[model samples]
Target: MHNDLPIRKIIHVDMDAFYASVEQLDYPDLKGKPIAVGGSGARGVISAASYEARKFGVKSAMSGRLAEKLCPNLIFVKHRFERYKEISNKIRKIFLDYTDLVEPLSLDEAYLDVTKNKIGLPSATLIAQKIRDRIFSEVGLTASAGISINKFVAKIASDYNKPNGQKTVNPEDVLQFLEELDIRKFYGVGKVTAEKMYQKGIFSGKDLKSKSIEYLEDNFGKSGKQYYYIVRGIHNSEVRPNRIRKSLAAERTFSENLSSEIFMLDKLNQIAEEVSNRLNKSKVSGKTITLKIKYSDFTLQTRSKTLPFFINDKSIILENAKELLYQDSLKNSVRLLGISLSNLNTDKKLSEEPIDKEKKSVSVQLKFEF
Candidate 1:
């Protein structure tokens, strides 16, 4: 199966602690100190942690309270996504200078197909080096690059030498590199899957590779074939250069549960404003609005409505959120409320079009007690 496919030179470039690094770059005082890019509130979660913070067992998606306990000196900084996006654009331009086959996974990571580059360079290693160098010189940030024969291996290789380093896996070495990798370290194999694999005595890539496709399918179902080929270094997923945003959302968990309708409305209004600001920043809108509620008992429920037209306005969002909130009485006291917009319209021109000042100025004000 591996010999049947062409050897495409793929490179995955990932920014080193992207958000936290950007914060440190902008604020010199944060340099050499442990910091996290996220909220510091009781229910807050860490979005990204600096390498210094990671030494203390801090990590992204960990609860902020736990991160604080892990690293007592950790400084929590609010996320500046717009600023990160600005730096990301600078890095992306550098990738385009080499090849148009760039697929961005997020603001700080992308997969580049340099099999046929603009500069006609033969070595993917050299191309990756130049890109990393340019990012440092031009954007004032460090990036790690992984060069391999395909996207799956390239993505994994990028993590091999992290924080201002690069690794290249030649076609012949692909299988060897994969076989030596830990099953837990493989992309897409989460804790649950890894535990299941461990129970089956599959601890590393070599163990996984030894299993028959029929056995993997019988155990893991549909994703079995995916693991079967990926372990053999046979991934053929092409770089999708035109990926679009699917949704925009904002959510907040209260330190104290709220049962009052007025209190819920006020929180909804704030969440709506955040969603509106992010939507306007990204120049996107959606027709579907989803309201998420999490009760104090940890039970969750979601309600959704699809509007006739796309909207990115706070007033519209808040009004719809209010309707969803009132649609049903409280089964239990809610500890969290969230609003999300989906079915996005990514057309730039539509977002850029002028809106009537009078209509856009309409704001929702909720009078409620804390």
Candidate 2:
């Protein structure tokens, strides 16, 4: 089945420690120093760390205090989104010169399909080399590139030689390359899933391939089929350019866990307001409201409720979110609260009526307690 699919030339480009590197590039004194880009306060989290800091086990998402403890000399630089966006725009322009089939995963990474390009380039490897060289020469920044037949493999390959490197996986070598790969490295397989697979004696793609689709489905639900095919090097998902926004979400981790229901409700209201603002800014609404709860122990749970009509109002979203929150009993003190909207009414073909009908606001009373 994998042999029948059309081969593509996908390249995944990722910047090397983007934020920290930018800071080091602009400030000569910070070069080769252990620096982190984010707040230095107790409650602050590290957004990015220089490769030097990474050597000391300091990484993004770790608390500033932890980072400081890990690397005592670590310098924390405040995030400069404007400068990062400026550089990102420059990088994006470089990609646009090659192909229109560019999917930006973030400001620092993107997937480009160069199977057919404006420059009429046939070799994705050569294009990747040129792109990396251009970035260094023009932007004073280094990037890594991964070339493969699909986005998943390409993305993983980009990490093979980090900082400033490239890796290519040919079509004929896809199976062998994937077979030797660790299950933990497979996209979408998180820590919990990997641990589960490990317990089931599936540690690598080779082991995963040995399992039948039925066995995988029976254990992993809908993701089972995905694993079964992907292990055999069969990923057909395309690199969609100009991808549409599907959902909007807002979440916050508290400085301390909250046990009181009143405090939880207040936090939920704040999250709902943020979600509503984002939805309004995007000119979109959704019928599904989900409440995400992260316990003090780090266990996570999400409850969702689908409404009949799309809504962008804070009050309406909060009302539905509250209902979902209470649908399941609280298991532990929550350390994080989040609200999100999905099943977006973005399709013009099936959303004309709902858009008009939901234009007006509908208020719902908020009275609840644990």
Candidate 3:
């Protein structure tokens, strides 16, 4: 439903090459050099890469061998998930000082709602600048931010100004911004989808808007509505107060430990069914499901699979979980079993995938509670 209501202000903040930058900050000797974070072994993939390495065509998720081919002297480092989480928490604290409406997308990116704030700051633009400055000074790292009327535009804006920069869009300028945007630049149009769209004459936002809503839906299923709203800067979602734990999971801690391969698979299937029921009732679909197990000797293991699209079917979840559980040899007795799902799409509206704009810091953060 489109409404000509007063616009809201929103901001998105993302750390630049967050993991790689932290590694550089902590290691010191690796500064200003091409570096990738991951193992260099045949099976290793780059989790993150510094901007210097990106210049040589290195990218995250590329095979370590490919990364090395791009940048011959590229340094590869193991992941440090714990350290990254610690820094993420610190950044959250900083955002809290200004507002309480923070939504963390991941360790390196977050959305803040500054409609109301603790600092009583007059403008969101100043708030965004301060956040960036403080993050650099306090966390010893750079961050990029985007400010706009809603999450869709704000997130895209942040990406426009990478490496310690910010971009903002006035509510009134949304049409102009979106009109000039390439169709591929719209949020949910992945590479393959974009190619299809291009073939159908959707090279720009104007082309998208020219199509009938019915036409879009016929071709793209449900997400075509998203294109309609974001192209006009009409996102109305409030910054949630807290994040809903998109999925809930439990892992049993065995007292003695049972080492039967069949037993481990059974436990995982059970948990996946539980998770699937919970998701359906919550009106959610999940794209990723993970399996976890622990051995009698206290050794831990996990495997995960991400589907091409979200689903809340119990049979699907359990079946995928079972497949992941048996992929490798489960010779040892297991002490724990767990299941989790992510990449949630709960009747998603126009989210952070729209018009590019300027920078504004949020004074408040929203957290969603289930």
The reply for model 1, stretches above 4 Å from the true place, is 244-250, 258-370
**Cα lDDT, all candidates:** 0.87, 0.85, 0.78
Pairs with steric clashes in candidate 2: none
Work out the TM-score per prediction. 0.76, 0.89, 0.72
Order of candidate numbers by TM-score, starting with the best: 2, 1, 3
Ranking by lDDT: 1, 2, 3
User: How many residue pairs in model 2 have overlapping backbones?
Assistant: 0
- Among the numbered candidates, top TM-score falls to 2
Q: Candidate 3's error at 330, in angstroms?
A: 21
Residue ranges of candidate 3 with Cα displaced over 4 Å: 247-370
lDDT of 2 by residue, 336-361 (tens): 88998988987433211121211111
lDDT tens digits by residue: candidate 3, 1-370: 2343435668899999999999999999999999999847765668899999999999986768778887999999889999999999999999999888898888999999876778877577788999999998999999999887778888888989798999987655667787888987887789888998998999998888787767888888898766666676556667775666666565655445667767666666677778878887777788888888776554668788889988788788878877887788885887678888887884344344343222122212322110
What's the lDDT of the predicted structure labeled candidate 2? 0.85
Residue by residue across 1-370, what tens digits does model 1's lDDT show?
2133556789999999999999999999999999999948887778999999999999997778889988899999998889999999999999999999999999999999998899988889999999999999998899999998878889998998898999998876777888999999889898889999999999999999899888999999988877887787767677768866789999998988899878898899999999999999998999999999998776789999999999999999999999999998988988899999998986332212232222211111311110
Error of 3 at 63 (Å): 1.0
lDDT of 3 at 10: 81
